[model samples]
Target: MRFGPETWSYASLERVSGQLAGALRSRGVQNGHRIGLFMTNCPAWLAWFFAISRVGGVAVPMNPAYTGTEISSILEVSDLRVLICEDRLASRLDSPPKQPPSVDVLMTSRTLQVNGPAEMIEHAASPDPTAPAVIFFSSGSTGMPKGIVHSGRNLVRIVQTVSMTWPLRSADGLFVAMPLAFVYSSIVECLTAIRVGATVELQERFDPDATVARLAAGKITSMMGVPSMYRMLLATREQPGESGKLRFCATAGETLEPALSHQFGERFSCPLLDFYGLTEAPHIIAHSNPAEILERPLSCGRVLTGVEARVVDDHGQSLPSGETGELVVRAPWMFDGYFRDPTATKAVLKEGWFWTGDLARQDAEEYVYIVERKKELIKRSGFNVFPAEVERVIREVPGIAEVAVVGVADTFLGERVKAWIVPRPGVAVNVEQVLAACRAKLASYKVPDAVEELQELPKGPTGKIARKELRH
Candidate 1:
C-alpha cells in the first residue's frame, strides 16, 4: 500500500499486522472479539484490520466522521469489546453512559507504528474463511445505518465477483481515495486488487486536487470512487495530463447521474462504470464493464455470475421484465444478517433472500435500473413520483453541480415534491429558474413544489446525498 511518498510492501503489511496482533493478544483480544476500527483511510488501517482478523476477531470498521450520537448507538448495539483509533479521535467517543467499551482504547498514528516481534503470524495458518470477519454499518443516507455482519468467505466471494469486471493485472496500480470504512473500499476496491497482487494507492480522505494530481502523475491504471467524488473531481480545473494510464473508473456508493457520467467520460476519456451493491451484500452484486456502461448508459449492468436478483410486488411476487418493483437479491456473499438485531434482520431477510428496500426495474436483457428507495417515493395528488427520475432531469440542467429530490409532508396531499440543489461555484440559482427547468420536462405533479439552492448538500458516510437531512 502506497500513501503519498511512503510505500508499505507485503512484508511490511505482514510485519506490522503481526506486531499489532501481538498487541491485541496482550490486551485480551481473543477469537471472535468485536473490535471497532474508527479512523479514516490509511495503510495502517489495513494493518490493524488484518491484525484483528488474524487473532480470530471480528473487525468493526467505523467511519471516523460518525457523530458522537452514531458512535454511541454502535457502542450500544455492536457489542464491541475494543475500539482502536488514532489518538486524535478519542474525544468523539466520549458519549453514552460514560463510554460503552469494556476494553481500553488503542491509539496509533495513520502510519504503521506497531513494535513487536514479527513471528506472531510467521507460521500461523490462514484465517478461517467462514468465521465472522467483519461487521459493517449502513451509510445512513436516509436514517441511522444498520450493523451488517460478514465472514471472510463473504468478503472473498465479492472480491472474486468484482475481479471479473476489472481487467486487472498484477503489475497494475489501483488508486483508492474512498474511505476504508465503507464496505465498497474494503472488498470491491482493495481486496479485489490485492487478489491479483496489484498495488494500491491509499488516501486518508478524498481530496479532489490531490486525487486529480495523483492521476496526472500516471501510475494508476484504475480507481474507485462514488458519484459525489466524481462531481467534485470534474468541478476542479486541474485536468489530468496526457500521461494518464487510467483505464476506467468504477463507482458504487450512489446512483451515477447520466449527466455526471458523461462529464466524467469527456473529461478523463475513460469509462465511468457504475456498479451496485448494499452493505447487506458486502459489495458488487451487479456491475458494468466499459462496453456495457457505454451501450446501456442508465442500466446498473447485469447481475454478477453467482448472484440472483428479482423485482417483486408488495405481495412478494416477482415482476416481469420492464416492470417496477422492490428489488430482492440473494448472493453467495450475503451478510450474516444484522448484528444482534433479530427484528430488523427478519424485516429485510426472508428465506435466504435479502429484501433490498429499493424501487427498481429490469430490462428485457436483465439489467437493473434503481429508481428510488421504497421510502423515498413522493405521493402528490394521487400520483407516484420517483426522486431519481426528477433528480436526473434536474441534474441535466445547466449550471447545476448536484441535486437531490425529496418528499416533504403536505396537508391536503400526503406528500409534496421538493428539491434541494447545489449550483456551480460561481453560478447563482433561484427557485423560479429551477422550477422553469423542471416544468419543461415533468408533469405538473412531478415537478418540485419547492426548490431551494444551497452551497452544498449534506452527505452520508458513503458520499450519497442524505435525503433525510434534506427533508427538514
Candidate 2:
C-alpha cells in the first residue's frame, strides 16, 4: 500500500517520509505538535501527513484553494509549529506574524531535492492507533471554521466502514480528484486505499479531459466525488475505450440530483451510488444503490449496520418517520467534537447525538432523505423558503445545468429568492424563459425574484457551494 508521485513509488515515499520525520525530530517537531500542510493535491501533501503520524504529531490539512489570509487564520488557530507548502505557492503567503518569533517553513521541492540522512521510506511502521492523526475544518459556524479532530483509530473506523459498505478490494484502483482537505474524499479515497492495500491513482487537480484520460488509462475501478465533479465529467466527450473497469461511482459532499445521476449512469453504463455523510458524524450514513434508486429514488438508503440515525425537532424530541426535522446522528465513529471550542462543541454534541444542522426525514423502512440545511432556510415576506426545495424544482427545468437559490435582501419583501444558475452547454438560458419554467413548477411566492446565469458557482475546496462567499 505504498503511494506518492508516479515516479517516486510507494517505497520512495516511505524513505522520504522517514527522512522527513527525522528531519522534523531534529528541527523540534515533537509528539503532539501540530504541523500545517498548506499545499494542493500532491504527493508531498500525503508525504507530510504520514511523516507527522510517524512522529506522533497531529497533521493539520489546510485547503490549498484558500487565499493567503484564510490560510494564515488556520495557522494561528491551530498553533502550527512547522508549515509545509509547495514552493510554487509560497508567494501566496503574506508576511510572517509579528508576535511569534519564527515558525519553520519548509517546501516540498527542498525536501525532495536534498539528500536525506535515512532511507526507510517504503514503510517506517509506527502503529500507534491512539495518536492524533489529522484535523479538518467544518463550515458549521457562520464565517468561522470549526476544527474537527480525528484519532488514528477513529479514521480507521471510517475507512473500514466505507470499504465494507462499498466492498472495495485490492484489484480496485481508485481515482480521486477532490481536494485532500475535505474529510469524506480524503478518508474514503486516499487513506482507505492505503489501509486496504489498493492501488491509488493520484492527480494534482481535476480536469475534465485529464480525469477522463486517467479513468481510461489506469485500471480505475471506483471513484468518489462531489455532484459537481460528476457534472463536469459528464460534459467531456465520450472516448471509445474500455469503460467496464469503472464498477462503482459514489457521490457525496452535497445532495445529488436525480436528474444528474440518471444521466451520468446511463452514459457510463455504471451505477452512480448516492451516499450521505457529514464532518461531525463522519460515516457512510446512507447509500442509494442502482436497485434502490428504482424503488425509492429519493431515499439516501437504509441506515448502516452500527449507525443510529434519527430526525428530531428543536426540543430534542424524535420526530415520526414521515416528518421532516433536523437530522441527528449517533455513531460509534463520530468525531471527538470541535477542537478548542467547548461551547460550540456542546451546542451540537448533546446526549450522544450530533445535531447535524441538516434537515431530513426518514421513511417507514428507515430510509433517509435530506431536504435542506436548517441554517439555509430563508424567510421572504413572512413565508419560509427552503433553498434546496426551490433549487430541486428549478433543476428539473430543461437547459439548467446548475442552480443555487439564496435569499437576497429586498426592499419590498424582507428577503426575496435569488437564483444563480449555470446553463447547460451550448444552450443560452433566458431569465424570462427560466422564470416561466419556475412559474409552472412553483408557487408564485416560491418563484425566484431574479435569475442570474453564471459560468460556474463558487465552490469550496471540498466542492460544496461557497454560499458564505457568495453573500458579497
Candidate 3:
C-alpha cells in the first residue's frame, strides 16, 4: 500500500525508478553527475530522487523559496548539468543562468500527473554505493549556501539504523507535512518510508486544519513535525479523531517543551518522541524512545544505535557527565563533507567526529539534553542567556501561540533579548503579561527587554524559527 501523486507500491517504485533512471541515462545523466530538483514536495521529487541515486547521479534538491540570485549561486557552484523542475517554477528562473559553469533544465508537469514511460528509461546503470547520492545545502559561515554531499551507503545506513532505533513497519502510513527539501524530513519520512515499504502521504504545504483532516481520515498512521506545528495543532480541536490511528509522533528541529509534550501525550494517548540531528550529520544521533521519554522528559534520548556521542570543552577535552559543552557525534550515516568547501568541512568533520554546533549536557544514564545552538546564545552584560530557554518559558503564556527570542543590539549591554510573538486568534495578549510569565521562570537577565507581536513568526527552509533573519 503506497500513495503519493500516484498510487505506487514498493514494487512499483522499483519499476518506475528504474524507468526514470533509464530516462535520465538517455538524457546523458551519468555517474557522479549532479542533477538538480527545484520542485516542492510531490511524488515526482521522490521518484526522481531514487531514480538519480539508482543511476549514480548526485541529486541536488534546491529550495523553491530561493530567489533567482540564490538559485543561480547554487547552480553555478554545483555545476549541475541538468535540472528537473516544475513547469510553474520554471517561470521563476532568470535567463537560465548563463555563466562560466552552466546547467541545463527539464520541466516536470505543472500539476500532478502520472509519468508516462519514456522509452529511454530502460538502460541499466551500475550504482556505486560509496559515491555521492544527494547534495543538500546549508547556510555557510561565509554567508552563502554550501552544498553538503551524502553517499548512497550513507543513506542506506541511516534507513537501517533509524529503523533499528525506532521500530517502523510497512503497515505504517507516514504523513510528512514538512518540506522534503530538508534532509531531516527527506530521510526520516521519505526515505524511511521507501526503505520499510510503508505508505506515505505527501502534502505540498502544511496547514494545521488540513493536516488534522488527513490524520482524522486515517490516511496516515505516523507523523513528524517541528514544535511549532505541534503548538498550532493543539491550539484548536481541528481534527478531533486524528490521534486515534496515530501510532507515534516525532518532534525535531527545535527544543521540545515538556508542557506541550505532556499535553500531547494526555490528549492523543500516543508517546511524543524527541529526535536530535543536524544537516551535516542527518539522522538520529540521539533519539528518545517511547519508554525512555517518560523517565527522561527533557532528554533527546540515549545515543542511537551505531552512533556515539560525547560532550567536550573548548580545548577538546571530554567533559564530565552533567556538564555542558559542544556535542561531538560519530555516526554511520554521517555525510562525507560539504561539497567543494574543504575549510568549512574540516572545521566540523575532525578525526571521524562531527562537532555539532549545538551545546548539550549528558546525565549518568547517557541521556542528552540540548541546551541551545551555540550561535543562539545571547551575551548580555557579561551574562549568557539562551534564547530557546527564554522562548520556552514565554510560550507557556495563555495567549501566546508562537514565540521566537532573538538578541538585538543594546547600548549598555552587548545585546538585549527581544521576543517576537504570535498571539492566538481572537485573543489579546499584553506584552506586560508575557513578560510577567517569563519573569517567574527565568533569571532577571533572561527576561525579554522588548516584545513585538507578529502576524506569524518567520521560519527558515527547515521549519525552525529564522532568528538570524528576524534580528536584522
Please tell me which predicted candidate would have the highest lDDT against the true structure: 1
What is each predicted model's overall lDDT from 0 to 1? Answer: 0.77, 0.73, 0.75
TM-score of 1: 0.78
- How many pairs in model 3 have backbone atoms within 3 A of each other, for residues 3 or more apart or on separate chains, i.e. clashes? 2
Rank by lDDT (best first): 1, 3, 2
Task: Give the per-residue lDDT digits (tens) of candidate 2, residues 1-472.
Answer: 2233344556666677887787677678777888877777766677677888887788888776555545665766778888877787687565333213366787675236334775433443365676567888643344355688888888888888887888677788888666677786578677787767677776667677877766676557788876667777788888766365688888765556677778887777777787777766665465746788667776677778888888999998999989999988888788887878899889989999888888999988888888876788555543446677678767877899998988775533446789999999999877887787766544456678888888999999999998765545
| Model 1 spans > 4 angstroms off | 95-97, 114-119, 123-128, 139-145, 239-243, 284-288, 376-472
Instruction: Residues 45-145, candidate 1: write the lDDT tens digits.
Output: 88888888778889999877665555766776778778897777777766433456475678777766545564575433356788789998742333344
Candidate 1 at 181: error in angstroms? 1.0
Residues 1-472 of candidate 3 have per-residue lDDT tens digits of 3333356665565666777777788788888899988887777678777788767798899876555545776776888878888787776575444323456677786343344575535443567788888899754544366888888889878877777666678888888766677786688677887778777877776677776777788877787876666766777675567667778688776656677788877766677788888777766545646777777777888777778889999877899999999999998888899999899889998899989888999999888998867877665543446776677668888988999888886533547789999999999999999988776545466789999999998888899888887786
How far off is residue 148 in model 2, in Å?
0.9
